[model samples]
Structure formats: structure tokens, C-alpha cells
Target: MKKTIIFIMLVAMNFFISCGNSTNSEITTQKENEIVSNNEENSDKENDEGKEEQIIKIEDNEEDEVVISKSQAYLDRYFQLEKELEDSLAGKYSGTTIDMKEAVSIEYDSWDELLNEIYGVLQEQLSEEEMKAVREEQIQWLTIRDSKAGESANEVEGGTMEPLVYESSLAQSTKERCYELINNYMK
Candidate 1:
């Protein structure tokens, strides 16, 4: 009778230990599965938001394209004329009459203000046709002048003027374009 009780007690203890291990394993597996599912849900949410943002970008870019293209064309035309005007002025007056240093100072609070003032002062003073004609003449003159300069450079010792001198000569043209664009836009 003593051996029988000891055997039964040992058997019950072994069975309970085995069941406890299985239960702990099942709980751990359940926790791991839950964590994995949560991660998957978060990743999917992020992907959806990214796709929406890309769609918005595409839409905005489409609208911007037309405006950007038009502005680019207008600015190109304005800059070309501005360059010609500067080159003409420099050829006639060198560094004497209108100093580049003096023209760069801006008293206006902003570009918009400057433009408004310019337009207010000059819109009625010149006609659009006159502006167009002047721009055409300047472009023509610049083409001729640039061709001559190129020819002269070809005849020189190194086939090109020194970079510094070339840059100085062109600086006025660049400034003229900047001013012209501002003034024209104001108009």
C-alpha cells in the first residue's frame, strides 16, 4: 500500500509538469503572433499614407508645369532684351555714365513694391507695341555684336579674351536683364 501511493503521486506530478510546459509555450506563441500582426498593420498604414502623398505631389506638379513653362519663356525673352540693352549701354558709355555699382542699390522693401511703383509710373508712358519693337531691335543688335566679338576672339593670341575681362563685360548685360525683368513684370 505504501508503494502504490508513492507511484500514484509521482505519476500525477509528472503529468502536471508536462501540461504546464505546453501551456507556457502556447502563451508565448500567442504573444509573438500578436506582435507580428501589429507590425504588419502599422507597415500597411504607412504604405497607404505614402501612396496618398505621392498622388498629391503628382497633382500639384501638373498644375505647376504650365505656369512654370510660361514664366520661363517670358523671362527668357526679357533677359535676352535686357542683355542687349546692357551691351549697347556699355559700348556707348563704358564705365562713365551709369555705374553698375550705383544701380544695384535697392530702396524698396520688396520686389513687388518696386514693380508696383514702376508700373504706376510708366504704364501709360509707353505702349506695348513700342516695347516689343525696342526688344526686337535690341535682340538684333546683340546678335550682330556677339558675332563680331566671337570673330575678334578668333583673331586674338589665345582665341579667347581673358575670362575676367569677358565676365566684366557681360556683367552689365546680366544686371540689365534683372532690372528689365523686374520692370517689365511691374508693367
Candidate 2:
């Protein structure tokens, strides 16, 4: 009987130790996952920063015309607005509707102003044929932008975030077009 009791105690102790080790393993796995997730988030943020810092380098062509770099002031303003939006959205879960709307409006105004500046530059610099080509390209770009914006909004259709998403999509598309015009034609 004593031997049986000793055997039972040993089994119970072994089971408890095994359960403790299993719990520790699960905790270790959870911590590792969290660390990996945080690292990936940090890497994404770094990539975004690198993109924001990228300069558009233009070279002179065979015509001997002067090459000009992209406007730093416009890039600065664009990134500033983006940072403001991110700052405003930080730590907020759902009640950022008003803030998001205001940010989108501000971004839209900035994008429109940059686009107008690009248009003015094109008018001053391009020949008639070049202007026509640019106009056709602009029309195509507008079609794409509208389609993309609609699609982005549709992804959140009937949700509270749809308007904000649509406005953000518009702003992003316009900003990208502004950069393209600056890089490709502003020489």
C-alpha cells in the first residue's frame, strides 16, 4: 500500500510539472509572436519614411534644357499634412470621424493647389503637341483616380468610415499625380 501511495504521488507531481512546462511554452510563443509583429510594424514605418524622403532627380535631355529637381516645398507640405493626419488618428479607435473628415478636406485643398501649380508650369513650358499629350494623359489619370476612389469607398460601403476612406483615396491619388507631373515634365 505504501508503495502504491508513493507511485501515485510521483505521478501527480510529474503531471503538475508537465502542465507548468506547457504553460511556459505557450507564454514563450505568445511573446515571440508579439515581438515579431512589433518588428514588422517598425519596418513598415521605416519604409514609409524612406519613401517620403526620396528626391525626384531630373536630368537634362538632348535639347540642352536645364534640368530642375522636384519642388521640395510641395513635398514638405504633403508630408506635413500626412503626419498631421497620423498624429490625429493615433490611439483612437472609432470616434475619429470628425477629425478624419477635416484631415481629408485639408489634404484635398493641398493636393488641388499642387495640381494647379503643375498645370500652370505645363502651360508655360510645353509646346502645343506636348500639351495635348499631357492633357490626354491627365484625362486618363482622372478616370483611373475616380475609379480607384470609388472602389476604395465601396470596400467600406454602408459603413461609417466610407466617406473618410473615399476622401483619403482621392487625396492619395491626387498627390501621386502631382509628383508624377513634377518628376516627368517639370524639367
Candidate 3:
């Protein structure tokens, strides 16, 4: 009778444990589904926002032609570009860790390209002295950008996450710099 009772107790304990695991698994699945649903809703909103942001480019016909167009337009376009890159990253975000790091680096590249383009435009618009100051400031900014990226990366040095953190910092910093240039210098 004692053996029988012990066997029955073991069975009951096993049943409870299996039930608990199933419940936990179900809860995790439910949370994942909700996240996917929310992301879809956010994507729909971003697409709608994209339709409304119209980017009109200001052409420079002469070496010193002033860009009378609203700087807001360029800013809007830059925002659009950022959204597109984010969408692209989201599409590939489910991949392995290395892929995520690469996605961030690619996004950084886009920001860097835009920065160079804006710098070129400023070169045409600003006089020699103004550009000299901007040039010095830009050099300083580059140093800061690199130092900041390194500092962030050092937090996770030699770990699998180092590249992702480093690249993300660079991308964020570059994006901020792009906006600063457009807001401060573009007329």
C-alpha cells in the first residue's frame, strides 16, 4: 500500500509539471503573437506617413546659388529615408546576430552618405570663411563620433554583442548629425 501511494504521488507530480510547462509555453507564444500584431499595426502607420511626406529637391544652378527652399522639406525627406532603412532592417531583423549587426552598419552607411551630400551642398552655399569654421567643426564631430562608438562598444568588448552595440551607436549619432546640419546650415 505504501508503494502504491508513492507511485500515485509521483504520477500526480509529473502531471502538474507537464501542465505548468504547457501553460508557460502557451503564454510565451501569446506574447510573441501580440508583439507581431503590434509591429504590423506600426508598419501600417509608417507606410501611411510615408505617403504624406513629399520631398522636393532644391536645385543649385550656380556655384553660389542660395537654397531658398524650406529646410523642412529636406528634413522630411531625410526622415523618410530613415524610415525606409528602418523598414528594411525590420524585414531582416529576425535573422542571426551577425545579420543584425550588418543591418545596423548598413543603416549607418545611409546616414553617412546623407551627411556627405548635405556637406557638399553647404560647401556651395557657404562662403569660404563660414565653410572654414564648418570644416573645423566637422573634423571635431568625426572624432566625437568615433570616440562615442568606441566607448559604447567597449562596454561589451569581446562579446558577441559588441558589433551590434557599436554600429547602433554610430547610426544613431550619424542620424542626429544629419539633422543638425540640415537645421543649422540649410536655409
Measured against the true structure, the TM-scores of the candidates, in listed sequence, are: 0.31, 0.55, 0.62
Which digits, one per residue and each the tens of the lDDT, describe model 3 over residues 81-141? 9889978889666798978878988988999899898898888878999899999999999
Q: Which predicted model would earn the best TM-score?
A: 3
How well does candidate 2 match the true structure in TM-score terms?
0.55
Model 1 ranges with Cα > 4 A deviation: 1-26, 65-138, 141-151, 157-187
Q: Model 3: which ten-residue window has the lowest total lDDT? A: 55-64
Clash count for each candidate, listed in order shown: 0, 0, 0
Residues 12-93 of candidate 1 have per-residue lDDT tens digits of 9999999999999999999999999999999999999999999889787975765455456545655564555456545433
lDDT values for all models: 0.54, 0.79, 0.86
- Candidate 2: Cα lDDT at 175: 86
Candidate 2: residue 121 Cα off by (Å): 0.9
lDDT (10s digit) by residue, model 2, range 5-114: 99999999999999999999999999999999999999999998776565222232424334333344555655775677567655442447886677677777778787
Q: TM-score-based ranking, best first?
A: 3, 2, 1
